[model samples]
Target: MVKEYYDPEVKYMLWDDFQIRHIDDLKLKVKGYSDDECKEFDTTEDILQFYPNFKDFIEQFFAEEELVNSSTRLNYLSNYADTKTYSVVATEQLTGRLHVNENLFKPSPKVMEVLHNATYEDVYLYDLTREDELAVEISKREEISTDHILIHSGSSDVIKTVMSLVLNKGDTVLISAPSWNYYKSIVELKMAKAEYYDVVPGKNSYEFDVSGLMSKARAVSPRIIIITTPHNPTGAVISASDLETIIKENPSSLVIVDEAYLGFSEQKFDVRHLLAAYSNVVFSRTFSKLYGLAGIRVGYGLCAPMAKQVFRLDVNPFRVNNISRKMAVAALRDEKYYKGLLKDITESRNFFINEMNSISGVKAFDSAANFVFIHFSENTDVQALKDYLAQNGYLVRLWTEGSRLAMRVTLDRKETMEKVVALMKEFLEK
Candidate 1:
C-alpha cells in the first residue's frame, strides 16, 4: 500500500464524523469475502459471518458502520422505481446563474422565489421552518381542514406522520402487498402491527389484489389503511372504484393513499375529491418519484384531521430546501413537459413489457410508471444481468428469491436500455 505524506499537526478523523452519503461511499469501495468457500453459513452457519460479518464490512467501507440493514438493501434503481438518470439536474452555468433540474427536485421556480423572499432560509445551513405554520398549510389539502405535516427522516415518515393524524401507538395498519417495500417497514417502525393482503398476480404486471385487499381491511379495522397508486414494484394503479369501496368498508380505519409514483401515472385520479366523502381518508404525495427529486426530499400530505394534528408537533422545519421546492414547483407548473416525459416513459415501459414478454424465459408485467419489472427464468440470478448493466454504466434494482427473475429497469429513452434488454435476452438464450 502506498502511504501519503501528511503534516504532523493535522489530526486524523473517524469516517463516521464526516457523514458520507451511502451511495457515494459504495462507489469508492465494495465489500465481499476474499474466500468464497465461506461466503455463506447455515442458521448457525449464516450468523457465522458475524465473525467477519458482511453487513459490518459493508457499513465500514461506506463509513456507515453503525448503520442498520446493510445487506438487506437492494439497489433501488433495479427495483420498482424508475431509475431514469436525472437528465434535467441543476447545471452550473458560466454566467453563474442557476437553473433548476426539474426532473430531480420540487417546489418549482415560483416556490423557490417564495422561500428566498422569506426571512427563514439558508440552503447551506439546513434550516428549519415553523412546524405549526408550514404543517398548517399542509392541512388545507382538501375541502376538509387539517394542520399536521411533520417531516421525518425517510419515506417511513409517511406512516409516522399519518399515524399522528389517525393512529395511536400499537394501532394496526392494513397494507396491500406487491406495493412499495418501505410502506411495510414504516408501519412496523411506528410501534404498530401490519396486516398484509397479497394481491393476485394477473395477466398484466402487479395487478391490484382488489378482493383480498378489501377483505382484509374490513377484518383488521386497522387504524391506518395504506394504498399505493401507480404502485412501486408492481407498477399497477388502483382503480377509483376500488378506492371508493375501500373507504366505504373501512369506516373505522383511516385510509392513507401513498401517491409516490403518481407523476408517472397515465390517468390522474383526483382522490382529493374523496376527502369530501370520507373524514377517514387522506393522500400522501412525494416529490421523489415524478419530480425526480429523490435526493432533495420534499413530500406533501393531504388530510383533514390528520394534517391538523401533524402541524402541532415539534418536528424539523424547512426540511425541503429552496432548491427542491423550486424544482417541484417547476414540475407542477410544467404539465406540458411532465406530460411529454410521461409519454416517453410510458412508451418505454410498454415497449419493455412487449419485448421482454416475447423472450422464452422472461415474464414482463404491465407498468404505468417509468420502470418494467421482469421475472426471469427459474433460478435466474438477475444480479448477473444487473452486474453486467452496472459494468455497462447502467444501474438496476435486483430482487432475491422472488416469484420471477426480478429486476427493475429504469427509463432513459436511450439506446442503452434497449441494448440492455437485448443483452438480457441473449444471456437467457445462453
Candidate 2:
C-alpha cells in the first residue's frame, strides 16, 4: 500500500535505475531507482523478490564514499585531534617537528643536489641498489643482519608485509584496546580477527595488562601480538621484564614490538638482541618521530633471517623510493643531530608535564616519549577546554577513549611550551 525507496543502509540502489545520475559530495541520484519497480526495494529480501540479481545489483549500486567512510570510521585520526595550520601551538602531532626547525632536519639539500645533478638515466632508474644500501645502514644502526631488514615506505608497510606473509583467513592477531588502530584495520582487511587486551592506567603511568594480554593470547592463539613501546597517545613504555614475560609466555605467537618512539624514551632498551635470540620477535622502527623526517616516509623492521626473507618476498619491489632511501641513510649518518633533537624533546616533555601538573584540576603523566599525557578532573569540561585551546590557536590531541578524558600534548620548543602553559593557566583561571 505504501511506496518505499531503497535505503542507503539496507538496499543499495543501482546506477542503471537512474537515466542520469550525479554525486556531489555524499549525495547520490539514480533514475530507475526512482520508478515504481524500485519503490518496493526497501530491504535485501524485497530486492531479491523482484530482482533476480540482488547481490550483483547491490554491488553495482554500492557507494564508494559510503563504503570508505564506514570502513575507516573508527580509524579516523581527526576524531580526537585537529590539524589546523593556523594554530600557534601545533602540538597535535607527536612528530619531531618545531615551528622554527622547518626543513632543518630534513636532508633536502642533499636530495635537491642529487636530483639537480642527476642524468636522464637516474630519473628513469628502477634500481633496488639504493634500497640495499639503506637496508645495510639500518642494519648497522639496529645491530641486525642486513638480511633481516627490508626497506619499506613506513612502519605500517612493515606491519602489512608481516601480516600478509603469516596471516590467513580466520587467523587472529592480538592488539591492545586504544592501541594504534591501523593494526586492527589491516587485520580486518585481511579477513582476520583482532583480539584486544586493555592498557590500564598505572600509579606511575599507563602499563600493559600483561596478565590480561597473556590470557587473551592463550585464548586466541593469535599468529601475531603487537606491542608498542613508548606507546602512542599514552606515552607509556613497557618494561623489559614485562616484555620478557610476554615473549616467553607466547612462544607460539610472533611478537612484534613497535618501537617507533624508543629513541625519545628516557631509558632506551636495546631490543636488537631479541632478533638474534628469538625467531618470532620483530622490532619495527620509523624515522618519522625521532629523526624529524615524517615527510620522507622511511621505516624498517628487524626480524630473524628467515622471516626477513619472507618479508622481502612479501613487500613490493623498490618499495622505498630512491630519494627516501638516500635521506634515510643521511638521517642515520647524522646521529648527533637527531640525538640533540631527542634531548630537546625530553626536556620539553619534562617541563610540560611539570607545568601541567601544577594546574589545580590536571594530572600530567610522566612520559618516556616525546609527548605528555594529561587527564583532566571530572569537574573540568575537557571539550570546552579543547575548544578554548583551538580558539586561541593551540592544537592538541583530545582523547576520550574508554572512560578517560585526557589531552596528548606533543613536546615543542621552550617558547611554544611556555605559551601552552600560559594558555592552560588562563583557561583554568577563567
Residue pairs with backbone overlap in model 2: 17-31, 17-32, 18-30, 18-31, 18-32
The TM-score leader among the candidates is 2
**Worst-scoring 10-residue span by lDDT in model 2:** 81-90
How close to the true structure is residue 106 of candidate 1, measured as C-alpha lDDT? Answer: 28
Query: Per-residue CA lDDT of candidate 1, range 1-430, in tens?
Result: 9778874323443222122223354454433233233232323324543465666654566566324545665665334232222122222222211112123222234445545565544345654544433344444433334342433333445555656545556788887765555555555445567888765457776777778877777677788888877766666787888888888788888887777677676556655578657777766777666755566677766655555455436345435554555455555665666666666666766777788888887788777766677777665556556544544444556543233336766565635458767777766675
Q: Candidate 1: deviation at residue 77, Å?
A: 34
Model 2 global lDDT (CA atoms, 0 to 1): 0.70
Local error of candidate 2 at 183, Å?
1.3
**TM-score per model over all chains:** 0.67, 0.73
For candidate 1, the 10 contiguous residues with the lowest summed lDDT are: 92-101
Q: Cα deviation in Å at residue 310, candidate 2?
A: 1.6
Among these predictions, the greatest lDDT belongs to 2
Candidate 1 yields a Cα-based lDDT of 0.58
